[model samples]
Target chain A: MISKEEAAQEAGWIERCQRGEQEAFAPLVERYRSAVFRVVYRVVRRRDEVEDIVQEVFIKAFTAIRSYNFQSSFQTWLSRIALNHCYDYLRRVRASHVTYFWQMSEEGQRNLEATAESREPGGLNAEQRAAVRELASQVLEAAPPADRVLLALKEIEGHSVEEIGEILDLKPSTVKVRLHRARKRLLKEVSSRARVRPGEPAGAPRP
Target chain B: MRCDHVLEILAEGDPRAREIKEHLAQCPACAARARAWRLAQAGFRELASEPVPEASVGFTPRLMRRLAESSRPAPAEQSFFEKVGRRFVYSTLMLALLALLALAVPRSGPLRSPNSAELMLMQPSVATLQDESVLNVDGLGSHWPHNSTVTAPAAGGQR
Candidate 1:
């Protein structure tokens, strides 16, 4: 949440931008660059492409700055543009069959299974957390682009359904349905891809 | 409850959360589904804990440069419809000018073919005037013969 003063300042910058002042846009970009980068990185999981996508998102926002009517926060508006750019990037990546650096190795797979099956009580250790991150990355790669983005937003980024709906221009109920389906699909992928010991099935319930 | 329904309830966090606990105890399949959901949730929690990447140094400068470049307009490349519309306007203007010329030409000068009577009246000679006594010259009496084609008529009197 932002204070009213900050919002007014941002509105001033946006108003200047709408009047064709390019310099006013710099402050807005500097303010939201990190947040947009984090979201793009979480969704795309591609460190190399995140910067480029973030730049495109800002340029798009500035280009369409006139359409903004202060209906939503500037961050939410920027987030919508970022997610749309990520979707396009994911589609292009899918079409080009590009390989990602986060593809889980054999050791990563083993660590992932061990971490999931571990019966430890409290917070996960660093190694277990790394394993889980690896598994999340793998799941993101295997899932379709839409599901990948939704899962990243809801699960990894910890955004609420209402926030996600605002970002994606979806109803809260629709966001709920989509989030449920994405989780189920990703779980199915993990079950099929992650291996189990001999005479035991994958994704077996905890004893 | 069916395993799928149980999973849906679990995923959605339905208010009837107690029902799922009972169903999990009764059905092994549902129990497995519930366990998988827990593991997945755990994985998500861990993933969420992972550090978020920050913008690198000079990111703003680089982005501003890119924005400056994007702000620069490209050389104008007209679309097919625009080209057609331009041509249409030019053609309409030309047609209007042609129509105006057509309307002004006959009013400015006598460009139409003259009839024989008008031709004879235009180039009258003294001999033709004498030969045709009934021919009126310079608006004189109809039956009188004029001596010369270029003769001047007395003011307010017959030539």
Candidate 2:
């Protein structure tokens, strides 16, 4: 949470930027870099793409700083930009036949290697964990971008309906509806693949 | 559980958040669906939480460079319509300003006057207007001498 003093400081930087001080944005970036990266990473899981998207988000925020209304906190406003870029990346990937991939950095590759070996609750084997990750990625890719975005924002990022609505330009009710549908779609996909019936434990064979 | 009931529970997220907890407590199917939904959410959240990447040390500089390039007067960044409209407006304004400038300012020394080229361009138009046919000052267009006592003709004079 940002303190009042911090928010005020942030507002000062934003006002400076809005007044045409382009470098004023650097301080703002320093302040919110981790937050914006975390929120964007929730939507775009590809480690290589995350940094590029984060940079694009800041570039966009800087370009559109003049249009930033102080209605919401700068964090909220920034999140909106990050999420929009994530959706655009998803759409571009969907529309293009050729894949746009970046070679993962050392940190990213190390983390991937680590997660590839990490096991979740229920003590799934390394192969099972990889399958889960692969299946999860596929579900995200298969679901509509909007749905996937709402799912990530709500379930993972824990944004409220109104906040998600503000970020995505949907009404609160629409956010709820969409998120619900997204959850159902993802659940359907997971269950279909795993054949896990209601009340049945995961990995159990279907009758 | 009903489909709407299940979705509402899923949307509620963490059935403990609302009275949905009581409903989930009573309905086994709703509870099962909730667990399933949670597992599904956890599935993706797991991947999302795998690792976060930060912008490199030079990210800000690169982004600022990109921003500057975009905001600078780059035609490729502008839309086709905008490019056409801007070009048209700019060309028209330049011509209009040049024409007005040529007529307003005297044709001073070529080396001294910045608008010398514009004045040169307007010279032909001025000469065309000065033609005897173009400037039909036919009525007593005589130059009256102010040095002498003779007064300039006030009434209409014979051609």
Candidate 3:
């Protein structure tokens, strides 16, 4: 949580930025670079692309600084911009047919398959751990762009529904409904591929 | 609890997690789904736990350099319809101005109204205008002798 003094100081920087002080923006970027990077990485799941996206998000926020009002906290406003950038990136990547785990190498495929069928995370080595994350990422990538971002924010980034509402500019109730629907669709996708049945244990079949 | 109700509670979380666990113990179908839900949740936790890559050294400096280079706002991309719509508006305004200019200017000089004789001449058919006598009356009335072959004005009118 940001204290009142820090908030006031950040507000000062924003005011300076709004007045065309380019130097004032560096501090804001320094403060939020990790945050923007983490969100972009979680949504897009490409290390090479995260830095470029983070830089672009900051440039956009700086360029459009005049539109920022004090109605919402600076962090929330910045997060909304970051998410919007990530969404656009995801859409373009989806269109290009890249980032689909099925297109990965034989080794990667094996890793994902083995990880998917495993019942527990214990006793997994580093590579297997990475595979677990990759399996989770594939499920998210298969979802629609809006739902993908929401799931990344809620499930992967550990944000609450209310926090998601602020970043997404949606009501908490709306977030819940959309989240519930997204989760259902993903579960159906996973289960149908795996052929999971009542008598059988889950994650037994490879998808 | 129904399978869906139990699953929803499992997936979305609830204060009655104990009840859900009890239901899962009693029901195989719900238990299968419960296993699935747990698996999915575990995957999510693994993803969440992955450490974010640290920004490389000189990230801030590189960004600041890029910012300086791109200080001017990039031109916004317009849709095809937007381009067409903008041109349409410009053309409409140009046409309106032209029409307003046309209305403002006074008509004069060669654009003056024709005399009654010209109006009468214009009213006749081409055949009537082709008549030599009619031409004589309008063109050579005074130059021609009275006794010449040229018909008199009254006779031409009669003709």
Share of reference contacts found in each model: 0.36, 0.34, 0.43
Most DockQ-accurate candidate: 3
- Which tens-of-lDDT digit does each residue in A75-118 have in candidate 3? 88988999999999888988998856564456655654565446
Candidate 3, what DockQ?
A: 0.20
Q: Candidates sorted by lDDT, descending order?
A: 3, 1, 2
* Alpha carbon deviation, residue A174, candidate 2 (Å): 1.1
The C-alpha stretches of model 2 lying farther than 4 A from their native spots are A98-130, A197-207, B10-38, B73-159
What would the per-residue lDDT of candidate 1 be over residues B106-131, giving only the tens digit for each residue? 54435632232354354444332343
Report the TM-score of chain B alone for all candidates: 0.42, 0.32, 0.39
Q: What is the lDDT of residue A46 in candidate 1?
A: 71
Lowest-sum lDDT 10-residue window in model 3 chain B = B107-116
For model 1, report DockQ: 0.16
- Model 3 CA lDDT for position A15: 99
- Listed per model, the TM-scores of chain A against the true chain A are 0.87, 0.78, 0.82
Task: Record all residue pairs in model 3 with backbone atoms less than 3 Å apart, i.e. clashing.
Answer: none
- The residue-level lDDT of candidate 1 at A166 comes to 93
